[model samples]
Target: MKVKTLEKLAKDMIDYIINLSGFEHIEDIQLNVVDNLESGDMAECNYNDSHGYIQLNIASNMINDIEQAKYVISHELGHILTREFHTYYVNFVGLDDDDMTSICSNVYEQTAEILAKRLGRLILKLYEQKDK
Candidate 1:
């Protein structure tokens, strides 16, 4: 797909995400399309704690594949959603400072991946229905 088309779709996906339950209170994920990623990954989610905003970066290479792009975006949305909930989890768990680093990263990533794929498919289905 073209960059313009991808941008529109990304906007739509972000809008869909923001309207969801936990995500409604937080900042919407911002889309940043770059020519290439330093890590050589297709995409990743970056959350700025200070500003309370999430940035979703999509590698220019993967933007051509709508499916891949959708997954990347949705996956990052999953991260945002998970991050939001994790904040509450942290309050309850009373985890040690040292343990938090490992637990937060591992647990959230795993959970986000699962939720992203499932939610991504659902989003795509919604799009399909609209198109029909």
Candidate 2:
């Protein structure tokens, strides 16, 4: 997919998720494309309370399939919606430095994946309908 198309889909998905979310203090999230991610990593989300915005990364491979794109985007949003990474964001904790924290992040990642696959499909359907 073209960068423009991927960006449009990402923005739409983020807006859809945020509007559905009741978190009032949430700041605007921005989606960016990065070419440097390690192989097989599709995307990642970084949110900061004091810095006031969520930054999302869309890997080069993320644009190949619309469904995959939605999944990657929504998975990141899932982390935000569930407040799964709030501690990491607020305290700047390193997921790799500690064994327990690493394990916890992994658990949350699975939860996010499940939620993302479901919500991602729904968001994709809503977006498709709007375009028609």
User: How do the residues 65-108 of candidate 2 rate in per-residue lDDT, one tens digit apiece?
Assistant: 78777766766766556554565533664455356456666775
Model 2 weakest 10-residue run by lDDT = 89-98
Per-residue accuracy of model 1 over 1-132 as CA lDDT, tens digit each: 466766777788777656644465544567777777888887787766555677777777656687777766766666666665545544665435456467665675467578777766776565546546
Clashes of 2: 0
By lDDT, the best candidate is 1
Highest TM-score against the true fold, candidate: 1
Q: Which residue pairs show backbone clashes in model 2?
A: none
TM-score, every prediction: 0.68, 0.64
Candidate 2 wrongly placed segments (more than 4 Å) = 36-40, 49-52, 88-132
lDDT of each candidate versus the true structure: 0.66, 0.65
Misplaced by over 4 Å in model 1 are: 20-22, 25-27, 86-104
